[model samples]
Target: MNGTLTTALAAGLGTGLALIVAIGAQNAFVLRQGILREHVAAVVAICALSDVVLIGLGIAGVGGVVRLWPAALTVVAILGSAFLLTYAALAARRALNPSAMPMSENATTRGRRAVAATCLALTWLNPHVYLDTVLMLGSVGNGFGDLRWWFAAGAALGSLLWFTALGYGARLLSGLFTRRRSWRILDGLIAVIMATLGIGMLTNALR
Candidate 1:
């Protein structure tokens, strides 16, 4: 690639990673799935592919359309908040119920379809994803002028790499999570994170 394109790609990579690395509902779900060794591949695939699609749309200037439609985001925010709150309640219940913590992969481990559904909801329903991938990243990519696509490519690659690493690397913590107390702590933290994000979205939508 040319110097300008290369610079754009580098900028895209940094921006993508910086935005995604933060702790959020999606990341929390991915980490829990990784710990349980349940449908990790599918979850990772959904997340990575979702990012690719969103980033592509952003590069195509769909961000402008999003900016024009405030009600669309408000709807998404409401739905996302409901989903996040529901998941948070589940997580909190799990944290309180020791019996819910599975020592081994069992039927209670989420099935592929269920996991896929949750993954899609967590990714698509979250308005923050739109803001980050579609608005922020899209705006940044547009700054690259003719090299915007190159920037999108870099951002997509960043998503692929980060999700792959997070999904797979979480296995290294498998040993640590084998204990019941660990599961409690994990679910508790997830509950807090999810609830906070959900409430924050609800508050933003109300305002």
Candidate 2:
């Protein structure tokens, strides 16, 4: 068990570090929530947990499943596009009504859950994630064919550590969200980002 921990940690940390440092949809959403201090802990947990699940699946050979069902990628692309567009519309609404933020706790919870679920969907549902994390990361981890598991373990741990720190650390800026204008601006930006990403994915799928 101890040895397996080391292997998992190494592989997880190595793979995790590579992707964790990169700027992507999940990180962007997490950072935004952190700044707003809305469900910071939940947001972080979701993001990290999502990564863990993906990485684990990758290591467990789900990458092969993804490879077999290429069309599933298209399905994910479509769903992700719709979700992003919807969220964007909501964000635009928030921009219009700044008070809607604090007064909307249940809404926030729903939004957070939606966002987290989206993050998971976006991360796992995409074939690219499997290609990178599972195929590539797994292959790399097994480099020496001996210490490869160690690499994967490290990668996973890196993701856990990075997401936790990022989500929590971003909350330090919660003070700025106090202003209605700030909320408007932030929400508006989120809307734009989500819409843009969604549209981009849709376009890619169409291509």
> Evaluated with lDDT, which candidate comes out highest?
1
lDDT of 1 by residue, 82-124 (tens): 9999999999988998888867344276679999999999999
- Give the range of the ten consecutive residues with the poorest summed lDDT in model 2: 102-111
Q: Candidate 1: what lDDT?
A: 0.92
State model 2's lDDT.
0.70
Off by over 4 Å in 1: 104-107
Give the TM-score comparing model 1 with the true structure, all chains together: 0.97
TM match of model 2 to true structure: 0.78
Task: Determine which window of 10 residues in candidate 1 has minimal summed lDDT.
Answer: 102-111
Clashes of 1: 0
Expressed as tens digits, the lDDT of each residue in 32-88 for candidate 2 is 767766677877777677666666666666777877887787888888788778878
Per-candidate clashes come to 0, 27
Stretches of model 2 off by over 4 angstroms after superposition: 1-15, 103-119, 122-127
Against the reference, the lDDT scores of all candidates come to 0.92, 0.70
- Per-prediction TM-score: 0.97, 0.78
